[model samples]
Target: MTLDEILDSLEHDIAVRDDGLFAGRAIIDGRCVDVIGVSRGAFVGVDEALWLSAQVMETIRRGGDTPILVIVDSGSQRMSRRDELLGLNECLAHLAKCLMLAGQCGHQTVGLLYGHTAAGAFIATALATRVLVALPGATPEVMDLPSMSRVTKLSIDLLEDMAKSTAVFAPGLVNLEKMGAVNATLDPAQPLAAQLARWFDVQPDRADVRDRLGESHGGRPVAARIAQRVYELARHVG
Candidate 1:
């Protein structure tokens, strides 16, 4: 199938009921999303993120080894008035905070990227132990190249020139690493759990890496800081 065809299915999705706990068997490195949808109510991305996060905590309270595989085939956040006012960044930050706590609780979170991941939504997905990605098929960026060029009103040619030896200007896996977005890319054909198992071995230290991400970019992304603070507060409050 063509790229557009592959990317099309993610646009409109159904939600599954997870009872607030993202607990279930995985695809063995296969796509976990297809197995788990809304699990509660509407399949809207931001709300779905919020729900799963709450579930993750419940699972942790119950026991050990809650290794959840969050397969990311998402493109971007749905544009909506409520979403804007509700603060998409806040919703995403909520999920990232949960994922970070999951790690501290001895859970291994893994994300298998199968499509474009950008902005705060991208940040939410990659907040894992070690991110396993597909081939060139998956695109990771803080802000995609086109958007950056368009919003900044800079020419694509000029941006391409900057990305020549620097990732600050481009949007890709390599560029993301330079920006400290994801940990590693996986071969599209590799099984997901196997990769996650490997990641479980060489886990990406979340807070440290996030600190680097923020340091490299001058300030951490707002969503990132919120998540960090959430964890910290949760610690003090508890």
Candidate 2:
């Protein structure tokens, strides 16, 4: 689904603003929530990050039991000398912290990924959400396979073959689900608004269980065990 279609489906009432930013009040299952959409894909810079941070902060300041819906389609962080000079990393970190604050203040955060979600853009925005849902055929990745092959010195064909069977380093929505990075995948033909309302009504606020889910799905067998061992060691030392 495109950004506009998703918004139209999920939001009974919405107003689109200039420069790929939009805010609206939505009612789901008799509960009201605030929705924000950022459509500036390809590259998200400091200004965009700060704008998102402010939106999240304002929601927390309002002090209501309103959930936050973030519609993300960004590909990566902006690559420019000016953005770097202006502390892009710091801006992204601030955005992440703002989302974290909203969660701490009892705001349920949900991310709907309808397009390209990659690298720092994914981490600073969508990955910060409490529940992440992706549309069918949406690709979320750290880096493209060719780039990964260059970085890791693996052959492209080998990586492709590995991706066919294992999702440890693949760049697809199904792979993300297998690794527990994505909570659920939505069918495009289904009623998106009703599905999202059901998710909002039923999904619980809980600690990250991606590792456990990954193990259960047989994608990452040792991650949970390794984490437990490290925690045990730390407890013993302390």
Candidate 3:
């Protein structure tokens, strides 16, 4: 097995042994939030990510901050042919939307990954969060390099190079860092709850290292600045 696959396999084993759910309580810089994650039971399969959407909304409705820390370890999909056939994109989009809603509603969405966090599995966790915490051994690649070659008809080496850039379609933590996909590549030994508590306390508006990443490496902030200017101009014009 490749180094990446081995790491992912180890993570998948550990998560399985640990049993998937870890719930915790803390005040993130005085903002009350109940952090939630997954491991076992009802939360399995391709449909699993969708389950958390309502839970997030309900947390907001109750005047409580309910941030989700997704513990991703599953492969792309196995029994999800039905999901794909039945418009899986929309299903996945709804889940992504819900995670954004949590972020917009003053709740922090976090992704903690080990094992193989690939497929829709990658998007479900990575795209939703304001901050992401991953172990050094984690394999965040979009797909094993060979799969991309088959689908895209590009040389594996070229595809590997492109995936390295976060601004491009590069998967994994390093690429995600540039695309503004993940906020932090944290130490796995630090404990999930403790790290979440720390970032949660830091208000999202302030530019942290993660925010600076997009601005510095990818020049992504240029677009944001333009958007901000457009909004201001529209307001004055109106």
RMSD of each: 8.3, 1.9, 6.6
Extract clashing residue pairs from model 2: none
Task: Please identify which of the two predictions, 2 or 3, would achieve the higher TM-score against the true structure.
Answer: 2
User: Could you tell me every candidate's TM-score relative to the true structure?
Assistant: 0.65, 0.91, 0.67
Where model 1 places Cα greater than 4 Å from the true spot, the runs are: 1-23, 27-45, 128-132, 150-153, 177-180, 189-192, 203-207, 210-238
Better of 1 and 3 by lDDT: 3
Off by over 4 Å in 3: 1-33, 38-46, 77-79, 161-170, 204-212, 217-238
> Which scores greater on lDDT, model 2 or model 3?
2
Q: What is the full ranking by TM-score, best candidate first? A: 2, 3, 1
Q: Candidate 2 — which residues are off by over 4 angstroms?
A: 40-42, 202-206
User: Against the unseen true structure, what C-alpha lDDT does each candidate score?
Assistant: 0.56, 0.81, 0.57
Winner by lDDT between candidate 2 and candidate 1? 2
Tens digits of per-residue lDDT, candidate 3, 1-238, equal: 2223322322122222343534444344344455444532222344555555555666668765555555555455334677767666666667677777777777666676655566665665555667776656566655666877898899988877776543545656666566565666666554444555676665444223454557775736675566667779999999
Better of 1 and 2 by TM-score: 2
**Cα-lDDT of candidate 2:** 0.81
lDDT of 1 by residue, 64-174 (tens): 655655655455554578786887777777777877777777666766555666666566655443444444556666786688899999998888887785666777766
Backbone clash tally (model 2)? 0
